[model samples]
Target: MKSTVETLSPTRVRLAIEVPFVELEPSLKKAYREIAQQVQIPGFRRGRVPAAVIDQRVGRAAVINEAVQEAIPAQILAAVREHDVKMLGRPELETFPELEDGQPLKFTAEIDVRPEIALPDLSTLEISVDELQIADSEIDEQVKGLQERFATLKTVERPAQDGDYVQIDLAATVDGEEVPGGSATNISHEVGSKQLLPGLDEVLVSMSAGDANTFTSQLVGGDFAGRDADVSVSVRTVKEKQLPALDDEFAQLASEFDTLEELRNDLRERVTRVKKVEQLYAARDKALAELVRIADVPAPEGVVREEVDHRKQAMADQLERIGASLDEYLAAEEKTEEQIDTELAEAATEGVKIQLLLDTLADAEDVQVSDDEFGHEIMHRAQRAGVQPQQYYDQLVRAGNAGAVFGDVRRGKALALVMDRIKITDAAGNELNMDDLRGGSAEHDHDHDH
Candidate 1:
C-alpha cells in the first residue's frame, strides 16, 4: 500500500491511497471462509465449500466487497502513521472504485487534522503575579479558627441569632407534593451561614425553639430541580459557642505547641508555604494566557462542531432525566437555548486550540513521561478520588483511558518547559526562581487539572 496527502486547509487534509491486488489476498481468503460458513450448498458442507463454487453461487462481487471492507480501515491507519498525520476525528471516506480482477485498489480519505502552530519565543516573555506575603492578621485568623474548633457549645433558651448553632427540622413541598430527599429532621446548622436553604437565615434569626416558619424557594437539585416550592423550618434547639481564651494553656490543650506564640509562628510558616504554591500556579495561569493571546491558534471547525454538539446533547440528556424542560432550565439561568449553544461552541473552539497547542509543544520539546512520574500522579489522583492507586490504574486501562492520562502528564511537562524559558516575577518586581519553586526536580509538578 502507498499513500499521498493533499493539503485541503491548515487543519484539514485529504489522503489518497493505492493498494496492490496481491495485498487483498489474505482478507479475500478470510472473507471466503466466513461466507462459506454462512451460505448453504447442495452437495458441500458449510466449511468444505470451494472458492469457485461459492463465487458462482454468491457472485464474485460479494467476495470483493467483503475483502475491501476488511482491508480499507487497516490501510487507512497505516497511511496515517506513515505520514505522521495528526488526525483529529474519524476520516471521511470520500471516494473509492469498483474492483476488477487484478487492478490496484484506490481510495481517498479526508480528515480534520491538527494545525502546525508558530509559538512565540518563550525566552522573551515574562509574567507577573502577586507577591508572596503572610501577614500577622492572617496568622491571628488561623489561631482564632483553632480556638473555635476547641470551643464549647452551650444550649440556650433564647431565639437563634447569627453565629449561633441551631438544630432544626426542614421540609419542602411543591404544589402540596413532598419533594424526594428534600426533608431533614434534627439537622444542625449555623445561623447566618446561608449554608442551608436560601432565605432560611432571615427566618431563623427571630425564631425561638419550637417555632416554625415557611419560605418559598426553587429546588436546585434532584428530580424536582428548578421548581418553586414552599420550604418549612422548625427550630428544635439553639446553642451558642464559647471559645477558649488565647493563652499558653489553650495552645497546649488544642495542639502540640505549648505556647500561643509558638502556634502563631507555625501558622505563619504554613501561610507562607501556601502563598508560595498559590503564586506558582498564578504565574502559570498568567503565562499560559499570554502565550495563548500571542499564538492565536486556529482549531478545525469539524472538531469544534462535534464537541459543541456533544456538550449540548449531554446537558439535554441530564435535564431530561430529571424531568425538567430545556426552556425551564434556560429561563432559570436567564439565557436562551441559542445563546447557550453559541457559548458552548466558543468554549469548545478555545478548548481545542489549547489542546492542539500543548500537544504540538510537547512534541517540539521532546517531552517524555517517566513511569515514576506517571505513578506519582496516579497515586495523588487516587487519594483525592478516595480509591486505591492500583484500582484506579486498572480502571483506566480497562476503560482504554490510560492514553489520556499519559497525555495529561506529557502536556504538563511541556508547560513546565515553557515556564523555565519564560521569566516570572512577583508584583513587587522580585524575580522568582523557578528552580526554588520546583525544589530541584522536573518543574512539571505544577497542577494539570486544566
Candidate 2:
C-alpha cells in the first residue's frame, strides 16, 4: 500500500492511494462471510455457506461493493494519518477504486484540512482591564437588592402606582369579538413592568381597585399574535412592598451579620470580588483579541460558511419554536435582515479566526485536556442545562460532539496560557497581577462551558 498527497489549497488536500489486491483479501473474505449469513441457500446453512457460493449467488459486483465500502474509510484514515493532515469534516471520494483480479486498487479522496497558523509572541501583547473599584453606590444598590428580597407586600386601598404589584383580570378582543385564549383571571403583575403586554404598564398604573380600562395594542404571541386587540384590565387588588428599616434587627433577620454596618461591609466586599471577576473576564477576552489581531491566522472558508449556516439555522429554529418569523425577529431587534446577515458573517469570520489561532496555540504549547477536565466541563454544562452529568455526556457522545467539547476545553487552556504571558494594566496605569485574582494559578481553574 502507498499514498501521496496533493495540496489543493492551504485548507484542503487531495490524497491518491494505491492498495495491492492482496491487501483487500481480508475485507473480501469478511464481506463474503457477511453476505453468506444474509442469503438463504438450498443445501448450506446460513453460517456454513462458502465464498464461492456467495460469489455465484450474489455476484462479484455485490462482493466488491461491500468490500470497498468496508475498506475505503479505513484506507482514507490511514492516508490522512500518514500525511499528518489535520482533517476536518468527512472525506469526499473523488475517485472510486476499480478492482481487477490480481491488480492494485487505486482511489482519490478530497478533504478539508486545518490551515497552518503562525502564532505571535505572547510577551509582546499587552491589554488593559478595568480597575477593580467598588463604588459606594454599587454597594448601596446591592444592599437595596437584598432588602427588596426580604420585603413584605401589603395590600393598599389606594390607586396602583409604579413599582406596586397588582392582581387583575385581563381580556382581549379583536374586531368586537373576544379572541380565543386571550383572557385570564386574577393574574399578578407588577405595575411598571411591561412584560405582559405593550402599553399595559401605563394602563395599570393610575387605576384603583375595581377600576377597569381598555387599551388597543398589538398582540405579540399566541393565537392572536401580530394582530391588534383591545386589552381590558380590571384591578382586583393593589399592593405596595414595605421594606424593613436598615437597622441591626433587620440585618440580623436578613443575614448572618449581627449589625447593619457589618452587613454593609460584607456587601461591599462581595461587590468588590464581583468587580475583580469582571476584570479577570475582561483580561481573558482582551488577551484573545490582541492575540488574534497580531497573529496571521487565515480562516478556512468552508468552516466559516458552515458555522454561519449553523448559526442562521439555530436562530431560525429558535424563532420557529416561539412562533416568530425572521421579519418579526428583525422588527423586535430594530434591525434589518441585511444588517443581521452582515453581523453574522463578521462574527463567523472572527470566530473561525480565533478557533484556528487557539488550536495552533494549543498545539505549540502542548496543551492537553485531562479526563478530569473533560468530566468537569460536562458536569458544569449539565448543571447549567438542569440535567444529569451522565445524561449530558451520553447526549454529547451520541451527537458525536464529544471531540468538540475536548477541543473547546483545550482552546480555553491555551488562551489561559497566553493570559499568563501577556501583561495587563488597570485604568489607573497600575500593573495588575492576575495571580492574585486566579488564586495563584497561572491557568484558569474553571472549565469552559462551550
Candidate 3:
C-alpha cells in the first residue's frame, strides 16, 4: 500500500491511496468463498460450490464490491498512520474505483485535521485574581442559616407572612370546568416563596386561618398550562419559626462546638477558606481566557458548526420536555431568535478553540492520565450523578465513551500545567501560588466538554 496527502487547508487534508492488486488478493478470495456458500448451485452441496460457478451466477462485479467494502477501512487507517495525519473526525470517501483484473486499486479520502498551533510562552502570561475577603456580615449570614436549620416551627394565630409556613387547600377551574391534577387538600407551602403560582404569594400574605380567596392567574403547568384559571386557596393554619437564643446551650445543641463564640470563629474561618478557593477558580479562568486570546489558533468551521447544531438541538429538546416551544422560551428570556443564534455560535467557536489549544498543549507537554487519575474522575462524576462507580464505568464502556473520559482527564492536566507556569497576582499585589491552592494537583483544572 502507498499513500500521499494533499493539503487542502490548515485543518483539512485529502489522502490519495493506492493498493497493489496482489495486496487485495486475500480479501477477494475470502469474498468469493463467502458468497459461494450463500448462493445455491443445482448440482453442488452448499460449501463445495466452485468459484467459477459462483462467478458465473453472481458476476465478478459483485465479488469486487464486497472486497472493496471490506478493504477500505483498514486501508484508510493505514494511510492515516503512514502519512502522520492528526485527523479529527471520520474520513469521507471521495473516490473509489471498480476493480480491473490486472490493475491496482486506488481511492481518495478527505478528512478534517488538527491545525498547527503556536503556543505563547507560559511564563509571560499574567492575570489578576480577586482578593479573598470575608466580611463580618457574610459570617453573620452563615450563622443565621445555621440557626434557621435548627429552629422549631411554632403555631401562631396570625395572618401568614413571608418566611412563614402555611397549610392550605387549593382548587382551580378553567372555563367553569375542573382542571385535571389541579386540586389538592392540606398542601404545605411557604408564604411568599412564589413556587406554586405567579399570584399565589400575593394572595396568601393577607389571609389568616379559615380565610379563603380566589384569584385569576395563568396556569404554568399541568393540563391547564398556558390557560387562565381561577385558583381558590383556604388557609388551614399558619406557623412561624421560633429560633433558640444564640447562647452556649444553643451552640451545643446545633453543633459540636460547646461555646457560641467558638462556633462563630469556626464559621468565619470556613467562609474565608471558601472565598480563597473562589479566588483560585477566578485566576484559573482568567489565565485560560488569556491563553485562548493569545494563541489565536484557527478553528475548523465544520467542527464549530457541528457543536452549534448539537447545542441548538439540545435546547429544543429541553424546551419540548417542558411543554414549551422555542419561541415561548425566547420570549420568556427576553431574547430574539437572532440573539440566541449569535450566542450559540460564539460559544461554539470558543469551545472548539479551547479544545484545540489544550490538545496541542497536552502533546507539547507529554501529559499523561494515570489509572488512578482516571478512576478519580469517574468516581467524582458518579457521585454527582448518584450512581455507583462501577455502574458509571460500565455505561461509559457500553457507549464506547471510555476513551472520551481519558481525553478529558488529559486535557485537564494540560490546562493545569499551563496554569502552574503562569503568574497570578491578587488585588493586594500579593503573588499567589497555584500549588498553595491545588496542592500540586490538577484538581483545579477546567476543560470545555466539546
Candidate 4:
C-alpha cells in the first residue's frame, strides 16, 4: 500500500491512497466465501459453491462491491495511523478508482484534523478573582428563602393585593380572534411575582373574587405577534401565602435542625458552599481567558465556522421542539438571524481559542485521565444529571464526545496544578489558601428513581 497526504488547510487534509491487488486479496477471498454460503446455484450445494461459480451466479460487480465495502474502512484507518493524522471527525470518502481484475485499488479521503497548538508562558499571566466577604444580608436572604419554601397558601375572602395569589381563567385575543397557547382555566398566578408575564401581575392587582376584566398588553417571550394583545382575565378566588413563624418549632419541622440558630448555621454553610463553587468557576474562566490572550497561535477559521453552524442548528432544534420557528424566536427577541449568526460566530471563535489553549497546556503538562478516574467522573456526572451511569456513558461514546468530557476534566486538573505553582493573593494582599479552594472530599454516589 502507498499513500500521500496534502494539507488543504490548518484543520483539513486530503489523503490519496493506493492499495496493491495483493493487499486486497484476503478481503476478496473472505467476501467470496461469505457469498458462496448464501448463494444458491444449480448442481452446487450451498457453502460448497466454487468462487468462479458464485461469481458467475452473483456477477463480478456484486463481489467487487462487497469486497470494497469490507476493505475500505480498515484501509482508511490504516492509512490514517500510518500518516499520524489527528482526525477530529469522520472522513468524507470520494474519488474511487475503477477496480480491474488483479489490479491495484485507489481512492481519496478528505478529513478534518485537529490543529496543533503551542503552549504559552504560564509564569507571566495574572488573573483577578473577586474575593467577596459573606455579608449578614446574604445570610438573612437565605433564611427568608427557606421560610418561603415552607409557606402555606390560605384562601382569602377579599380583593387581591400585591403578593396575593389569584385563581383565574385567562384568554387572549388579537382583534377578537382567539390565539394559540393563550387560553387557560383554573390557573393560580401570584400577583407581583412576575411568573406569568411583565404587566400581567399588575393587571390582576386590586381585583376581587368573581371580578372579570379585559385589558390590553404586549405579550413577552412567546409566539404571539403584534405590539399589543387583548387579554381577558376572570378572578375565581383570592389567596394569601402564610409563612411559618421562624422559631424552634419551625426549624424542627423544616429540617433536621432543632433550633433556629442551628438552621441558620446550616444555611450559612450551604451558602458558603455555593459561593465557593461560583468562585471556582470565575477563576477557571479568568484563567482560560488569560491563556487565550497570551497564546501565539491563531485558531483555524474552518473549525470556528463549523462550531458556529453547529450552535445555530442546535438553536433551530430547540425552537422546533417548542413549536416555534427560528424566525419567530428572533422576532420575539427583537433580533435578526444575521445578528444571531454574528454573535454565535464570535462566541465560537473564542471557544475554539480557549480549547486550543487548554490542549496546549495539557500537552505541556502531560495531562491524562486514567481509566478509573474517567469512570468515576462519568458516574458522578450521570448522577448529577439524573441519568443512569451506563446510559450516560453510552451517550457520550455514541456522540463522539467522550473526548470532550475527558478534556474538561483534564483541563481542570491542569488549571489546579497551575494554581498550585503560582503566587495567588486575596484582594487584601494576604496569601491565599489554595487548599481551601480545592478542599472537598465528597464522592458522588449514583441513585436511580423509578
Clashing residue pairs in candidate 1 (N, C-alpha, C atoms within 3 angstroms): none
- Writing each residue's lDDT as its tens digit, candidate 2 over 86-179 gives 9876788886677776777899988888887778788988889877777788878988998999998999999999999999999999998899
Which predicted model would earn the best TM-score?
Answer: 3
Q: In candidate 1, what are the lDDT values of residues 332-374, reduced to their tens digit?
A: 6999878998899887887777777788889887889999989
For model 3, which pairs clash? none
* TM-score per candidate: 0.79, 0.83, 0.84, 0.74
In model 2, pairs of residues that clash are: none
Alpha-carbon lDDT of model 3: 0.86
**Model 1, C-alpha of 316: deviation from truth (Å):** 9.7
Ranking by lDDT: 1, 3, 2, 4
Candidate 3's C-alpha runs over 4 A off are 19-23, 26-63, 94-106, 305-345, 382-395, 439-450
Q: For model 4, which pairs clash?
A: none
Comparing 1 and 3 on TM-score, the stronger one: 3
**Candidates 1 and 2: which is better by TM-score?**
2
Span of ten consecutive residues with least summed lDDT in model 2: 441-450
Per-residue lDDT tens digits of candidate 4, residues 334-365? 99888998999888888777666666677888
Can you tell me which runs of candidate 4 are displaced by over 4 Å? 8-10, 27-70, 93-103, 121-123, 134-137, 150-158, 171-183, 197-199, 216-231, 240-272, 297-334, 339-349, 384-387, 390-412, 426-431, 439-450
Return the top candidate by lDDT.
Answer: 1
Worst 10 residues of 3 by lDDT: 439-448
